[model samples]
Target: MSELFPVQASEASRPLASRLAPKALTDFSGQEQLLGPGKLLRRLVEADRVASAVFFGPPGTGKTALARFIAAKSGAEIVELNAVTAGVADLKKALEAARYRLGQSGTKTLLLVDEIHHFNRTQQDVLLPAVERGDVILIGMTTENPSFYVNAALLSRSTAFEFLPLPEAALERILDRALGDAGAGLGGAQAALDPEARAHLVRMSGGDARRLLNALELAVLTTPVEMDGRRHITLAVAEESIQKRSLRYDKSSDDHYDHISAFIKSMRGSDPDAALYWMAKMLAAGEDPRFVARRVLICAAEDVGNADFRALLIANAAFQAVESLGMPEARIPLAQAVTYVAAAPKSNAAYLAVDAALREAEQGPPREVPLHLRDANLDAKSRGHGQGYKYAHDFPGHFVFQEYMPQPVRFYLPDGQGDEARIAKRLAVLEALKSEPKAGRKGEP
Candidate 1:
């Protein structure tokens, strides 16, 4: 097999991302933590020691770029294969060439595999021998978690490094470089980005360097040059080019937790409009529907609590509906749940009570159950478990008071809000009946 596929495009005709790809490590825009001084990958790259490894991360986080940089730095005979298209036959051919090159001229061959996760177990196992014996340096790139997708044997033989999404500041620097590089960038076109346009592009890119460049390329190439002989990208042009508003909610970033926080707070504050808006944003941004459903369930229990016990039922039904129906359709049920939780009477009494009870339990030794409340089975009675037990049903109003715990622990303090006020009224009447003089001691010890 040929060592490399024929190059398809001329340099001038290449895409912006390909044209501006860093030729050296120093020119790389992001991944400072990995390529910084004393980092493992950097040390390995700098020493020309190419290890069989997997670069795993989200899309557009420099996995393929890093592999290219490694191959360049190693000064080895390199062959790139995409796992999506290449197979075991291609692997064998590559290895055959690698072995011949090493034996003939002592040249190391680096096999850079993109989308390594696409290969199944059987296909992945084919490379173990060469990788284990150090005959070929393997660089596999993937966007999925390697632990779940890659085979154990193959994964064990390779080191895996996680690449994080590029930060906004790093992306800004990349944009600046792309605009100023005369040969490979938009410098020749005298293109300029308006302040708001630049901000929108950065936000919409979601920390992906390739995405930012693509959007910028689209905006500049399509916009007409003004009389000033300069192509200016205004916010309106940027919006039209991108074709979607930026929500800035990344599932792996802090924005995910922050948005959830806002959604729950809005529901708790009884602002249906805000709650629905946040829910819409989350759903539109491709957030997991189950995740949103789970949060809504929690809000129903903690915020709506006993004041509107039905809120829990409604929220749970909505969750079931969401699971049954996936995206686009799931949004309807999710919105329904959000609006219901927000409109329902709000109370956190149950939430506070459970937390208070847990704290008291943790502070002291376990308390014994009072004898009257203990199990009254055949064997339990032998230990005087039900000695003073009086059936509440045998008394007036079916409400005789009796001790339940050996130690007094007052944990539940209802706030007398909504339906909780009714419970408070009933408990007050029961207390009066239990404390009234000798007449109230009919069933007491």
Candidate 2:
């Protein structure tokens, strides 16, 4: 049979790509964190506690496969639905049947809905009661942010399982498996991928495993076998494929997050070369220069901090210039802003401060506003309005050290950022003046 088939299963396996489809959970590649021993999903399946979940991720990241595994393990019958084509009535019938089987045959119903985000609130609302009652195990798959797209009540009933894109190592393993799978034994065909082609395929696929397989299949299927090594895909052939690919940088999909992550990390690593590379990537992919500008401004404040106050000003200027000048010409100011912020001093102090303050806000008491600082605008404020307010500015440098914060709260703990050092020094001097009783200004604690 092996000799006759040259591939196993169906003729689909004869293609280098199709041969590697994992039929079972154990055979699946990538997502070791979910499958590894002591993993949550693995434990849930074994314990029969596989809760209804949302498998969120990029394209071809194995959401369907994982859903199948869950249904298989839970002694359930899985009914698949693509929210795009499936209507509310179909959903109602599907759930009803699943519930019937669950009650009669001890077979729990797992409704695996793909692109759950595409379903309108009406459709999602239909599923809410059943899910809340555990009538059916609702497994939703989406490439979008569930928080934004999913119905709140339904979301509350199910857990969310995030699946990131396959890493390089995992993608490489997928490639190797495709080569070895007898079912997909197109390996027997007369074509071998060169080093450059392999690298190009991986890079172009952008961590999407399905894309890698499909591209590999297309590349081989399209090329006419030449005498010189079965029309091996040269870098040139691979380049053509990549060139033809559409650009979608600001797509707010997985690509947006992935690209931004790479850009920021590259900058943080002090690699201008990589920063520029990602910059070009963002530009090529049509990322909003305004969005990029905003990010730079935030990065300047959060990362660069006081190290280079100029970076902050430049980022803000870039944002303004982008709005005023528009594209083509705006790209210049945007580029300059990105390079400057990336090259500036990196500090996480400001970032950490807000985080710390929020943490404290969560834990500490909400202290009442100081009596003197309370709003006196309304007529209800006639009671001792601005009564204790001392005109300290009349006495000194229009500055008075006062305990304005209720509960002794301190939010702005400035660090030794770019120009922040000068500001910090000024604060210290003012603080010292308040402590001096001779200055007739008692330091307010």
Candidate 3:
């Protein structure tokens, strides 16, 4: 057999990442920003260039794959080592081999080390000469912060590319691909995914493609199949496959969107119990705390508003707490925050105000600020800039007569809802004071 004609390896021997490993950048699902045209890695490969590089990200984010991919393309010799397995002596051995091979063959060297964060400072310093002299391109991968874990001497030489966890949509696509993949586990199983189960697989996997596929592989295998025309996997089967009993859960897939919808609607409907229930469901489902906090913050400002001003504060504080503490302990603060927001007085008055303002602003030239409100500090500024702008503090009760809104611009008509009803009354008195300033004894200078 000619050395030029390569044989594709059998399916079972391949790790899912290998079997599913995208042959080209085109086959790769995630890292669109990195793989899209004019991207960093793509540019280096296209130029037949070797840059000392480090890929920093969470596990299974294609870091090692990227290292190997670059190595294969560059016609370089790869020296592999896991930090856990390789000591200073083993590292020196690999360095010797890579350097010797490079010198003999006129080849560039790629040292693909996984969890390079595990390398001690002294161990890492050994490779500095090779990296600096361009004898080897050190392609290091780490799940931890490189700035903290890596030797500053070595860090200075490499370009660090931070990889991100795939989004839910990309994860969804990955799940489908894994199940639909013939060479992988799901092919002969007659598996038809339940909407909820599919979502569960994605949500539980938590944006790790390897995790996602492994769980989906496990889930489908656990499923009991039935023959309708062919063996079709069912919701019950998926439930059994996932958690053994089944959940009406899955964030991006089924229960994720559903619970969020339920939570929002529960708040809008002023059903605290339902809202809290949905909130708990989201947390238990491993929904990101920041995501949950973001929604509550929106609900506080948009759905509760002045009806319960403290809701926004609570929601914001909860977000901060979650960020500081992360999981487990953070859940308590999040739960307290959600309960507070849900129990608060309901009012869409603020959301309505913005919605109305945007609608009117988009409608016509009236969107422009009144001349009185325009910037007046610069050259050739008009006289009307602060002319009728009454000094409210100069009068009693810090109130004064003024037409701040020029004409009849009513962005927030108050809606006469909840506390807004009282706010509307106060606004009426202000308008009246402007109309008949003399009668407003409270506004007299």
Candidate 4:
């Protein structure tokens, strides 16, 4: 029930990211849209008027830091709970303590819930009354889309702010600050970062300030001081410190949908390079090869359509290859399918045609099949089902004019691209033949 704060570690022992966390808004590196001068969020925090709100975004974007800063500025008792670790009982205790403090000492508690999206509907619902009645100012932080994961009632009562990845310039500024700040930063280390090393850290951080600082700290702390009395962090040292760039991707979150959407759109837009890049990023981030293959297959059918009939074949082959041979080797077939689909002539005509026909079938009045086109074997002689049927194979060019449907409807207009161009020409000739009068009908007119 006691007010919870981030575990207090000694300054010397705490991680650089924790030690160098911004103590003031001025020290915060990024999120200009939210923390910039005269912004609504900044004004709210400055005025100590921040109530129930949700901060959602990728990590190292200053959500938690801002929450702590808000609590400090408003002089409110801050209670921190990680949804990953906290249960219903823990939540109840925090809320009860907040209510008691508010009533007894005229104090307000700022409840910071990290990864709030991990909480189920029941857990989220528990915070609604406290939030609605203003018993505690709830600050829910999540990386997932709040609208999807957070309860509707809880979300509606909260102001949601999306934090973006820190820009390169902001990240650079943070690196500079961390290096120069004598009190909380590594100014005492007297470490001189090589130009290439500095750029490598910034570029590989992927707009994450904490990642940049952590890598910088590791490079400096582990390297031996040179004769010049400075620990020199070269490009090699920086690479060793942050070996692999952690791509921002979660299989069940925004990154998964966004990356796939980008990949599909790139292929549809005929940008093979962009399509390949997104595909690689998804795969590198542990996306299933089969999932990527499935998307490629859909794109071929829906976007490539009949323009390049071969595209669908290639996509299907790629899907089969992915299933047979997984990972590293599967990437080749995926690349082949992605590039082929992206470069192929695109036409959604076939896709559109089926959808338009579906709407008519589902919504329009019912109509029976034309008598001539009905099953002839059942009642060819008695019912006159096939009496007037004109067999196209019996005529020249395998062509004949006949009513195939009770009510004719136009669908499947082919866009002139790839093989569809030849199909369009063939259809045009058929239309011309249909316009001409039959051999014996000219005298009657």
Q: Provide the TM-score for each candidate, comma-separated.
A: 0.70, 0.69, 0.54, 0.96
**Which prediction has the highest lDDT against the true structure?**
4
Off by over 4 Å in 3: 1-10, 228-231, 235-445
CA lDDT of every candidate: 0.84, 0.74, 0.73, 0.89
- Quality of model 1 by C-alpha lDDT: 0.84
Identify the runs in model 2 with alpha carbons over 4 angstroms from their true place. Answer: 1-19, 37-51, 68-77, 100-108, 145-148, 151-159, 228-231, 242-282, 298-309, 345-417, 423-445
* Tens-digit lDDT string for candidate 4 (78-188): 898999988988898999999999999988988999999999888888888998888899999998889989988999999999999998899999989889988889998
Better of 1 and 4 by TM-score: 4
Alpha carbon deviation, residue 374, candidate 1 (Å): 17
Task: Give candidate 2's whole-model lDDT.
Answer: 0.74
Best by TM-score: 4
Candidates, ranked, lDDT: 4, 1, 2, 3
- Which residue pairs in candidate 1 have backbone atoms (N, alpha carbon, C) closer than 3 angstroms, thus clashing? none
Colliding residue pairs in candidate 4:
none
User: TM-score of predicted model 3?
Assistant: 0.54
Error of 4 at 355 (Å): 0.5
lDDT of 3 by residue, 227-259 (tens): 563345555655554453223465544346667
Clashing pairs in 2: 8-183, 13-184, 19-184, 303-347, 306-417, 306-418, 307-417, 307-418
Predictions: Cα RMSD each = 6.7, 7.4, 12.7, 2.7
Q: After superposition, how far is residue 308 of candidate 3 from its true place, in Å?
A: 17
